[model samples]
Target: MIKVSEALAIVAENSSNMPVQRIPVRKALGYILAETLYSPIDMPPFRQSAMDGYAFIHSEKHQYDVISTSQAGDHSNIKLNENEAVRIFTGAFVPKNADTVVMQEHVLANKDSILIAAMPPQFSNIRNKGEQIAKEEVVFEANTLITPAAIGFLACLGITEITVYKKPKVAILVTGNELVKPGKKLPKGKIYESNSVMLEAALQTIGINKTKVYKVKDNLKATKKALKGILEKYDVVLISGGISVGDYDFVKDALLANGVEELFYKINQKPGKPMFFGSKKDTLVFALPGNPASSLTNFYIYVYPAIKNRMGFSDIHLPKLVRKLNDPITNTTGKTLFLKALYDETNVTILDGQASSMLNTFAIANSLLIVPDDVEGLKKGQLVTLLPIN
Candidate 1:
């Protein structure tokens, strides 16, 4: 068995970014930019009005002639003389020679002219060309994540598409003979199969929607055949059972038969000690324990980061923090413990049902307290590492 940190290092070393592809900016949310993007044009390419008011050349006069009206998306070339104002709405292109704008509420309107009740400063309420960002300036660097606001900002610049790393093609295989699908009658000695859907939903949370699930019986022949076929096409394969040394377990032997290079077999951690990570050619494989809690914990710790790394994310691990423990705890098993907990700003409370087979605690947990193997016990007020999760 290897230490948790060593396993993480191995995964990081093996995971590589996927190929780059140009996609529509609207569809690029949550994707990592594959190239540095430069602003094609100045933001607010022309002088724009910042409010729905009158635009005119600055003068000390309290009265002005209303020349014309300009709203958003208008290309009026109206010019303004001294003490002359034009009715302009927000986001409208301000006419040339206009240097000031006053809110309509601050002016007394007449039939064809307005009297300024409040004389504002020169060049007020006007967004100069490139005020936000200049043309050819770096808008986003390579590896920056695409967010909703990013898409809207790029759209304002008339950018239709952007280059980003493609998400991985993943395949999940659930192996066991005693597992039955949900909504079906369970046999006397069988349990419902849920890891496949649970893992699929977890992948979806990270915007990985292209995934297929397969079922393989607890037999070497079937496991080998399934592995061979999936490895040929997918970039990542997740096996959710049959890795232990039980008589029915066949994933480990099947993976070897399929010629996968084992990078690591197990980690010195509780709830997910029997995890397996390996690769063959370009395809990465992870075999997690059959238990639901163990399977999900290993996914968060190992598989999630690997997938994010392959998608070109620099920050691939779960968001972590340090918080005081609400109660004391002990680790007599001498293994790193991933305890499900509820955390606020200052403290974390470890919940019950830390068993590998139960997910009740995980369902309500907002974070996972990582207790290192070297630590034998912790006091109520001691600080510990916490990983925030959904």
Candidate 2:
């Protein structure tokens, strides 16, 4: 087995670089931008009024003639003369020679003229052209994630669509005749199958929605046919179970039989020791151990990064930090142990149920306390690497 870091590096080098395509700005949320976004025109495209009252040149003012009124979306370009004001509402274009706007509540209104009871600072209520963004200004850098505010800002710049990297189309295969679907009666020694559902939800959290799931018996022939079909259609294939060297384990053999070359077999890590990675042409594949916690851990560490790389994201790993251990733990084996942990403002507590098949404490976990393989024993208050999960 190789170190976890080495396995990550190999997967990084082998990840597929998906092509970028133009999509509607509304559909680009959470997607990495493939190109820089520039403002098409100056924000607002005109000098605009920032308040509702009157628009006029600032000076030692008392009363002035009220010209025509202008509200938001008005196309009229009514000009203002000296000592004259125009009734203007918020977002209305500031007519020529108008330099300021006073709030309606602070002004005394009459039929012909209005008194400026409270004078605003010169040019105080005027939103000048290009105040928010200039024409052709670089609004967003390449690889910037599109947010809700970005959508609003892009709409202001008259942008209807943007270019972004495409999300991966994934196919999942859960192999094992001993596995039974949820809601069905547990007959004999069979357990409820949950890997596909968990993985599908995991993929959804990363913004992948185009996914198909299939189930196959442990037989080698059936597994091979299923792998071949999924490999032909999907960009990524995730197989749960049949990776370990057991008599019924046929994932490795099935992959090789279908021309899927193995890149790695296992990592020097606990819970997910028998993880397998492979790729054939444009389709990347992962065969995770059947244990619930083990498969989930492998997905977060290896599969998540590979998919993120294809989506053109810069950071492809879980958020990590160093925290003081709240309790003592021991690692008798050479494998690096990843313990489910709960953390507060500063400290992290390693919870119970670190077993590969047990997931009772996983629901309460917010991070994984990584105990290195070389470190056999750790005491409380020691600073250890922690990987945050939401």
**Alpha-carbon lDDT, every model:** 0.93, 0.89
Q: How many residue pairs clash in each candidate?
A: 0, 0
> Model 1 scores what on Cα lDDT?
0.93
lDDT, candidate 1, 1-390, per-residue tens: 999999999999999999999999999998999999899999979999998899989988989999799989998778788968899999999999999889888999987999999988999999999998999999999999998999999998889999999999999999988899999998899999999998999999888987899999889999999999999999999999999989999999999999999999989999899988999998999999999999999999999999999999989999989999999999998999999999998999999999999988899999889999999999999999999987
lDDT of 2 by residue, 1-390 (tens): 899888999899999668899999887888889999889899979989888889988889779899789889886767777789999999998897888889999999999899988888888888999999899899999877788888878887889999998887899999999999999999999999999999999898888876899999999999998888899988899999999999999999999999998899999999899988989998899999999999988888899999999988888889889888888888899888888899887799988888999878887898888888899999989888988888
- Show the lowest summed lDDT stretch of 10 residues, model 2: 74-83
Off by over 4 Å in 1: none
Task: State every prediction's TM-score relative to the real structure.
Answer: 0.97, 0.96
Kindly report which residue stretches of model 2 are placed more than 4 angstroms away from their true locations once superposed: none
